[model samples]
Target: MPTWDNVPKGQMTAAVLTNPGYSADPSDCFTYSTDYPRPTLPSPEWVLCRVHAAGLNRAELRGRTGAAPFIGEFIIFQKEYREEPPKILGEEFVGEVVEAGSASGFTEGEKVTGFLNGGGKAYDGAYAEFSLSHRRRLYRLPATTKLPWNVLAAVPMSMYTAWGALNLAAGLGERRKKDNKPVVVLIHGATSSVGVWGLLVAKDAGATVIATTRNTEKIEKLKAAGADHVVLEDDIDTEVLKIAPDGVDIVVELVGPDHIARCANLCARRGTAVLVGPLNKNWSAGKFEPFYIPPTRNVSFFTMTNSGPGSEDADVDHPTVEALLSDVVHKIETGVYPQEVVVDKTFALRDIGKAHQYCEENRAVGKVVVTVP
Candidate 1:
């Protein structure tokens, strides 16, 4: 329904896939769509940014492969998307604002970073040179001297999801009290991007943190990210129990079905456990009461999803969501949040097939980013 007449002049190169199917590497799914139209402000509150870098998410792979909640059965399909010809598959980006709408609060030349969930939801994506986003979702970035543009691409998606699960789902920030003994938080699968950001956000909230990761090399890095205790994935229960005799106040479970019950059992009475990622192949846990019932604690469970009631766009200026996008950026700017940009690898936009292949291989330690020339 939106028109491109208002879109900027000039052609931009983008990675696109016209057909959909499963492949061993998924590199074959991509085609370099040349002469793409540059994006313009879609609304008065939106701004058009010239994307410098875009990060890949596992959901992109799932969507390409026709997985549920992404592209298969559950996710609704629109006729416009089907008839639109090429499909772009990226959600997060860091760039410079090229044009601002009349009501957009940002300046034209400011650098910004943000997550726009439009690949399968509403708008196109950031794989192209130019992308549009709501002004409230865009956060001003410090000078490239403070943080490079490529590095910030890894922050928006993972950090925002982590912040959302904690603030929106678990209410960790609202419940945190500095005067009292710090709240205890547990992060399962802490080596992943979301898990690592959860650890940092929990620590930034003044909570005592326990993290689980298989990588021995990242133990010290995890500690530096404000984790009070870092233990192996298998040792989570033992190490966490040893530290918090009662149980943890909050649990961010990145590992799925197999570990969900254990994570729930580790929560204290009236505690909260947020299941942000389902890494396990099987999501069904049989019966909830029998397999997952906490022995002593009546804990609450929150499942983080891409589309839901509170799963709206990230508003930096107005943070109804658990820390605003601006809040997390400030944390990184100030010394409260970890400033490390853990990019596993980078690829040119034309070689996006290789980028998706790299992420599908599941060997990358952190985020896989694609650079736009």
Candidate 2:
């Protein structure tokens, strides 16, 4: 065993969900425990990391509130709530490798950032002093990058989801490569972290990006973040029609299922509308009719977790995810993508409940992060 510093004999401090159910106040569900068992490597592909910072996602809030159907099932079906230790919730983190298995291809003290399907049986998450991650789930940060741990922590999940939604699911990259025509993209909920990243990515790809935000205060910020035009969410269709005339070539729908019809209608003929996030906390689209989606346009769904190892399509999708992550890191390093634009708030790990509350209230314009000190 490698000698580890600041690690207790077999335990570590972590913010855990003592109860997995809805609470109007997020603080009621989380507890800080000093004796939470340090997760061990399950196999040679996994490594233990000392988490420096973690990024909060809306999914965690949904999962905590029992709104996430799959995550809730994973926790309840595993009987995690009835167990001695409850579940930890987090998906993206920046940290250092403290212990590595041979196949993990990482050395002790190597700085890294990663995303995992946390709050599951395989391993706990990054809302702790320590986290466990598989080698494939991580990206080794370049030594010369000037980004901080909190900013780096904000990148993995949001960036991966944005890139996947656009390139893999919606074929933004392929379309850009094949057609010399200008591509117009509409990113709904563009003030959210993933929406902002999607705007940046589409802009970087030379698209004419029109972004949407309900808050008028975020218009200038969205423009600064590379939105060609920013419109109020209430009148997006009217305003966007004024800009594009024939509808946009792609629509990144981060709002929720309830708005899929509007998103599909906004897509140009033969264009795609990719559903990336549910910022509105609405999961179901009841009483759907196929006519709601125009035949000339397409709608697709994307989730980063589904591409991880062991998923049905992982063999085909995982490698693409790895390449995309490395490419994103490279872009950040080269100044092609801005890192500072994505992080809106930082809270200490001890203030996790407050962090959750901040995100749940939709108060953050970008990513909300918690640093572990």
Measured by TM-score, the strongest candidate is: 2
Which number leads on lDDT? 2
Q: Write the per-residue lDDT of candidate 2 for residues 1-373, one digit (tens) a residue.
A: 1222233349888888887676777888888898888877767877889999998887677656654334332321232222222277777788899999899888898878766653433346788998887777766765556777887777877887787788888888777532566799899998888998898889888888998988877888888888899999888869999998888888989999788888888888888998766787776666667688898999888774443235644522445665665677778777787766778899998888899888877777778999997
Give all TM-scores, in the order shown.
0.77, 0.85
Worst 10-residue lDDT window for candidate 1 reads 70-79
- Could you give candidate 1's per-residue lDDT for residues 136-182 as a string of tens digits? 55666664435556667877778777887777777887775534789
Alpha carbon lDDT of each predicted model: 0.68, 0.76
Candidate 1, which segments miss by more than 4 Å at Cα?
1-9, 40-46, 68-86, 103-107, 118-121, 139-146, 174-181, 214-221, 224-226, 257-259, 281-286, 289-327, 330-338, 341-344
- As a whole number from 0 to 100, the lDDT of residue 6 in candidate 2 is 31
Which residue pairs does candidate 1 place in steric collision?
Answer: none
